[model samples]
Target: MDVLYSLLDVHIQQLNPIIQDKTFTNTLNFILTTSTDDIVSITTPILDRFCINILPTIDHNIKSLILESKSMERILLAADYPSLTKLKLFNFKDNIVSYYFTDESSFRRIFREQITDLILIYDKNNDITVQREYRNGIHEYIMKFFHNLKYLSINGPSSHLILDDSSPTTCFSSILTKLCVYVYCFQDCLTLLDGRLKQLTTFIVEIDHSEPSSIAHNMNNLPNLTTFSIEYRCNTTEFDIQVLPLLRRMSNLEELTLIIYNENRTRLVDGTYIHNQILLHLQRLYKFNFYIRTCTDLNNVTYSLSSDNIQQTFTNIGYRHVKCILYNITRMVICHAFSLPFISNHLEYLGNTFPSIVFTRVTKLLVFDILPFEHEFFIRLARFFPFLKDLSVMNLHPQLCKSDSVNYDHNQQYPVIEYPYLDSLHLEDSYIDYVEQFINETKIRLPRLKILEVDYRKLNTITKQFTRDVTRLNCAKVHRLIMEKQVVFPKTFYVYFPLLESASSYSYYFKK
Candidate 1:
């Protein structure tokens, strides 16, 4: 019975952790069966054993179930969970709503009667925006379907559940106390605060686009809301107009996190501006974490502003560990500022000019520059960001001192540039040399690399149409591969990438 404590909150993947490690592996059956007429071709003997031999023995004690779309029904039928109250669904889409949430389903009664917390991971949104999954259908239904839904989280950037004035009141949830989801438009964030979900106390939203939103004139302060966080990926120039008004409404918030990305010279989200405009207003706020990257074009600026100008702004502010760096390339100044130890697990647009600091916490890093990423830079990166798990190299320019060329002439040489823990690498927007730097076994080693995103052109050029043995070690380990160009599944591709299960074509976008 002591083992039942761990089983109180059951994640289906726990039974088959090795097999269902990747995103493609977990939802592979669901993607295949739903997209085509094929049944689930994959077998799960462990899951069968859990259901047949284990679940019935401890069903009454189970309080939570986190499941995926394909085997959720089988797992539910195997047990009558008397104490189940929390349900987190992965790979949840519009097509499966009827399969699980409707009256036709056997577990529908238990879902509506027992579940109070629901987390729907749409599973496709790796970036900020995704379109393949359900946008509004599943969200609108769950608000009414769950009789006691207190905490509702819809993961993914496109899970924007927006309702206009014509929307029915049934879509509104008075029982919901915490809501974390994405919004399509800036107005949708405002729409959430428009007397809907009257009991929502903690709100975390990611606004994909900052379009022109009609400002709510008499917006009431969110007194009940103690937690409010936003990640506005507005590449457009509307951060000031669209974001500031929304923050003013959360005057009573206790915890606040703002990760805003945009380009602006004058209207910067620097420490001084944040202190004067934001922190001063939120009197109840005790905790705040922020990562604000605002690019400034010095071409049109009348006055000069260096990294010193921005870093000095944090001197008076209470934020002691805040670091600011301005990467000046040509006429464009990339202002990257954040409160350390790293706000999120990711950092972007970093270059050779970045300050020497140990970012032990940042697991995902994006290195963007027109200048060639030299071998020394990689050595420096491996030393500073020791635990980088996912790395994105976005340089169209090739490396000057290529990995093979490094220490060819000089006696002083850098140690092997090894990312021992890196699981994913993205060279989709980079050159063939970078592909060589990481994949070529002689150059560097990525022991845990499983996912590779590259351009077909560079990949083909480097690996010589997937015939090179130099990259076979990494290509063999990569389970999922993403190429900018559509790839023909030639025998060579398969020969090179033996462990490949998923390969898709995608275009990687960087800021203008």
Candidate 2:
């Protein structure tokens, strides 16, 4: 028998059994090094038990600790962690910031010499007005305390916290190698990386559109940087020109990811030029991911490039290592926007004007915001991507119904569109009739098909009833079925399919 232990949500009742078992106790001593929870405060009973009984036994084994502001002092004082090298502090309050850095505090001695990796997360729930000031003060104070700190992560709403250049307390450790923070401007990011963090190799920052040109100029200062990522929220095409030049400066970058929420209308010509430029410039880049998001209604949208245009654009540039997808944003009850992956390589031919392009090597595809009316468009996708294995479609317009006039028998006379390697299919908020027909038609073509996931949140009462009725007739060779909600199936389903068991209310798996 194998047993796994987790420190999350641990119950006091469960502790007695583990304490009694000598083998389990030994395992606990080895495993319970890191406190891995975002708990605001530890209850007195749990705290007392941990300090008096638990910490002393496993102190030496602890290599890392993650604690909330309220419980950090009590837990650290419980026992000496000689092996502790990494510490993460969360939900920090302004009042307790000075205590930990003071000479009289126990943490000063423990962290001053040994700690190398430190993560400080500000409480997001706190008043936003004061959080900024608190974060800056805490960051400045803690930086002075850790003499050998190499890796630091300051996570909060914004990475705008800037250290005073003239502050006598400013201690930029030469040993620091990696930094992750959210910056308000590009200059502040450069200030930290320019000369202060000379040894920094990995830097991740979130910046606004304030100073795009400055990035390319200042990036050269951090010659040691190997991996760099910038996330910016902009709705314009002007940033593209600014970004490409920046990429050219980072010749040392091995991995790069750009996430932009593009609000401005983009044309195919501009997109094509940018795509080609990245490939031409980033010669040493091993891994690159580009996420461009736009807000537009599916009812009236024009793709800048067609599938053929996208394929030809990349082909023209002699680049085939990228994949582009168009998503249909659906407004859900809980979330503002829920997007479904839609229109992979062949989306160019989908008659929509949205520019879609992807590498020929891509096997998995996600398409979103497809009109339920287009049945042939969906079927033709499999024929385009012969290598497609997994496909997920979301936010399908609900009005479109499967054509009852078309005879499957007559259709069988023609050459069937096939995806021989296709394995997994996922549909979200789409019409069930069309899905059933698509699956039934493609069953033989998809021999490797194993999983089918359907989200029927938008299915009407009549459509849902029709769906349940057609399940037996629409049966495909899929091994697993995952639904958004629990479904009541016909008794015949179980009789015909004995191997299938309900793994959960929303999931059904084949036992075999």
Clashes of each: 0, 16
Those runs of model 1 whose alpha carbons end farther than 4 Å from true positions after fitting are 1-60, 125-135, 162-170, 213-218, 235-237, 299-308, 355-364, 383-390, 396-413, 420-424, 428-432, 447-461, 464-468, 477-506, 510-512
Q: Mind giving the per-residue lDDT tens digits that candidate 1 earns over 1-512?
A: 22332342367646543332232121112222332122332247656665776577656656777676677888889978877888777766666777678877898878888989888876552343435444453577887888989999987534666544424363588789998887766677777777777888999887766666445533777778999888877654577666777788877889988887876545455778888888888888999888889876766555677777788888778677788887777777788888777766668889887778888888888998878988788888988899888888988887776434322322324566688878778888777778878877666778778789887877776777787775677778888898766767667988898888888886543321
- How well does candidate 1 match the true structure in TM-score terms? 0.79
Index of the highest-TM-score prediction? 1
Q: Candidate 2 lDDT, tens digit per residue, 86-167?
A: 8887775556656676778777767898889888776655655554445444555566778888898877654345543423
* C-alpha lDDT of all candidate models, in order: 0.72, 0.54
The positional error of residue 109 in candidate 2, measured at the CA in angstroms, is 1.4
